[model samples]
Target: MKIAELLRSAALVTAVAMIPATTATFAQVDGRAGPEFAKLFATYQRIKASYVEPVEDEKLIRGAIDGMLAALDPHSAYLDGSDLQRLETMIDGNYSGLGLSVVMEDGAVKVISPFRGSPADEVGIKAGDYITHLDGELIYGGDLDEAVQRMRGIAGTSIRLTIFRPGRDEPFDVSVTRGVIELEPVTFEVQAGNIGVITVNEFSRDVGQDVFRAWQGIQREAAGRVNGLVLDLRSNPGGSLDEAVELSDLFLSDGAIVSQRGRARGESLLYEAESVYRGEIADDIPMIVLIDAGSASASEIVAGALQDHRRAVVMGERSFGKGSVQSLLPLGRDAALKLTTARYYTPSGKSVQEGGIKPDIAVPQLSDPDWEKRRKYQLRESDLRNKLINEAGLKDEELVEDNLADPRFKLTADELKEQGVEDFQLHYALETLRRTTPSAVALRR
Candidate 1:
């Protein structure tokens, strides 16, 4: 592929923590690095010559590369062979698997989030749950890629996953039937009171256009003026950066959308409004953005932009707070480095590195039976190992807002279920919008 197209391809998946990338020729190595290189070569030679078992050069080299990247950050990695193919398959958005976004955490595979309506989501596999075994076979301390490969199979296949939920007393097993995961990036529905609810599952290719079309569809379906809108991004492990910008631009007519700063030349960039869509699709409608611990990367970009612009009322919990950008620097024909290149910021110049986008109104999912338990173990960017620190520095009080008791959120899961409320956060947002006047939406600015 051409270099530009290759760069664009990198931003296509974020659930697995891939982001946008640009290729660049390697610069000449510094002469002072000769001694370090000599040490590395000496170690390689010693391993090949003195190790008890005959180790392949390819295995050693790959191990060295993996070790080097692992030291940098959780996101950076060496991609080749199966890894490269998996990325390509993700970009295509069709695979026979139990659809999930997961990350390796301290030798265990922890779910970032299950894709909406996927087999895993259907089977009640939730974010923050750790998979200890697959088909009753211990998988802890194993390779994440291998575990993921085992979970994916023919559509009719079923996999038994042993889950260790943080608040649960014991590990439980779940049988998930693998199916063709065809990601529907965007979906829209018109609710009562002519309100539109648009759920962005991920920021995959053409998501901006998809959202624009969704608004158009909602308008047609409503058959009248839309009163309010809900942009549901809960558990949306983010995707493409460009699509994030495009989606943000759909709601923002003017102002700085997002910016990235890096040490390398040409790495820094500033994206503004009117670059993708000319004007807001629903400029006058009251809007609310729903986020949670699973909303990350590109998801943060959109939330931060709209919140900074005061165009939407951001509700729910703080986001996953992944503000850094990654680049897929090609090493050879098959190998590439997914390296963290730059840190992005909101229009208000807030870096969402460790301190993710805090909601304007903190609304907990009271309908979740394990809401309190899960909150105690909720994971965010700050929870990740070796995460980039927010230069602004997060205060203790800021990150610890959940500890306060709120009498308003006392409804139990059973109580809410009896009241016919499946999702408390969405219900809250919809009710907020339904009751909000146009003047009230404007007053948020």
Candidate 2:
């Protein structure tokens, strides 16, 4: 069967953490059905007739569908009932739960990152921690959907999570109160020296418009021209491909923003500057985009575009490389398939599949007490099972940067806290802006 026909969905739910949708009719089976199909049919017949117990057709069919997508990549999956509802909730940009982005790795539920200012983040839940149990019950080797359902509840309800931090010798439990997760896609403030700081928490609907308004707000608040701009995308899991393109268009007046290539025809497309927005809003303002290991998908798209055009200097550690594009194909009225269809590339023709977008300046977060320990065990797209390899043929070791001592970044977590610096990465970016002029900062490569 043709892949496109097998996967079809009514609505396309697209995000960095989840990319979804394509509408296509199933093609007729032709000579392409080789001996493998006959073998598969025989196996299915034998299982249906000779299993130890009676098996429902639904279970067997669903298993077969899952098995097909599982071999493709980690992002692709079958969505039904609660899964579909979850996707809708994400698109709507609100839900009641402990705000978190998680994934299943070897049957273990792993935390990707906690949303900033959420209950999970407030309780000191860091990324790369394994959630082995929920509410004192061992949940290891359980279904991911069940674990997620257990985590969700009405606002004000509490859920106890048993966490296994990799660097720690023992597992620990923490109680978190669930709350309504109302994501503010864009937030901004005018900092000292008229530096405009805009934090994009997630890329939801109208994100580009929100960012533009933020710039206007900063300019108005400053009562004059803003000295510089800091676009903080740390810990931002990507959402909405169109939003990414729109945001990139806001900064660049010309040139290709990003490109997508797929195996099938009509899947290749290029997005360029001035296509979404007319012109640059902050043309003369010195700009810095801060990204870390948690920055991914749509975040990478924005950062990569700005970097390629020399429109902004990207700072912080490397991003979570996730360059593939997933199409949400609807299987029927109540089910869908989230399938990886294409891989994206920056304007410079760089695929951030395994090798993510490297920053112009590598700035680590020194304000967190466990930053060092967490850094050693940090996860990224390349770390996932069955991840698409970069066509450039980069090795796993080569993708990882060696930890080196830096004289400029010598402050410890305690020292920074003592100095009242809550976020070392943001502080460093602001400091960099205060000291250097836009002309003084040169683009690498």
Candidate 3:
């Protein structure tokens, strides 16, 4: 991400109680230092007076504001008024732009996930797709936020995209009309042979409601008969922390869901699943949650919480270790600051900071075409970072196995023959849940 782009979301702290009560909504920031209002004005004058050339005071002041707020944390941020309003709208999972979740992977805005029913998703954008251009202008090697802002416009507006995908020669282009992105969090369907497959891609404000609706649909389709639920959390980078807790509450009871700790706050926040909404699934039904490295943040929150509470058997490798919580602080002019405030804990008082949550059964992902042995190249994290930085482009075939950090093991598909997990850890979880549930029922009786 470009510095300028991040500064676009800069935020300031709350004033002292003595300060005039403006908006009555400033986040409760611990204020010790008196107002910098005078110092701020002096700094502005200093910049205006001492420069060799008359620098744009407005731009420099904005940068200073961004710098001031960013020092707080990664999540507290200033928002340009428009950006602020958009941020509010985003909480509901709907935005009037190309529906794409992107990040700066290797100096370029790489597409992580595309929301279904959004223009980006409908245009066949997949996870890991690197977007190189918008409207024929090369956006690579520049501020990622600037590139993103260029990609958004009013709903029904047409925008162009240049993407690089694996096994493709040259970048491709797609023109899509931006539409209202209505995020559908959960969707389920009975797979062949009666496997209940549920896809939970991301969490938003609507996740709890969406999940409840999906559960109802699954039950209705089962027609008074229900099999085990395969709750898919693959490629889910996660969203709201509260929503993750709410989603976990759907299944768990009498166990912690997640916890948080900071400098002043040290007591463990145990989240027991209240019998808030009794459903037919309850504890008797066998359940499994599929996760991967892409399943991070709030996604890990849900998976870890459920697994700890013995609600769902988790499959796949260790989750993406992102247990830190970020608070979005509102900066002036619509930008905001995203500050990392505290480390969140699973209901069991565990933190997945350096070590991700270990699955009961690990299933490393193995795609065909073994490349590790062919290359025999041992690459460290720094090597990959350097590759992306120097290349300034998206190279897909270069994506080696993403499951190397698995809690169980990280191996590709062909490797499964000698050291294989063909069913992956997920299959093992299903079988285990199947056998354990019935036997547990027998014992309970």
Considering every candidate listed, which one attains the maximal lDDT? 1
Kindly give the stretch of ten consecutive residues in candidate 3 with the minimal lDDT sum: 11-20
Model 1 residue 11 CA deviation in Å: 3.0
Model 3: lDDT to the true structure: 0.62
Report the lDDT tens digits of candidate 3 across residue range 1-445: 2324333322111100011223644555557444676677887898889978898967887788767755553334455654444444445556678888776655788776777668887777866668888888888888766877777779988988888765455778889898887766788886433556678877755576677777778777777466577888876777776667678878765556777665433322454566344442445667788886567778888888877767777777566556666655444433445555567777777766545567766565454232223223322222332111212232333333354554444555666656544445555555555565455521122
Model 1, span 271-371: residue lDDT tens: 99999978778888889999998888899999999999999999999998888887777665667788888899999999998889999999999998887
| lDDT of candidate 2 at residue 300, scale 0 to 100 | 94
Query: Per-residue lDDT tens digits of candidate 2, residues 256-368?
Result: 99999887676788989899888788788888999999888889999999998888889999999999887766565677677888899999999998799999899889998
Query: What are the RMSDs of all candidates, in order?
Result: 2.5, 3.7, 8.9
Model 1 ranges with Cα > 4 A deviation: 1-8, 15-25, 395-398, 442-444
Candidate 2 accuracy as TM-score: 0.92
Name every residue pair that clashes in candidate 1.
Answer: none
* 2 against 3, candidate with superior TM-score: 2
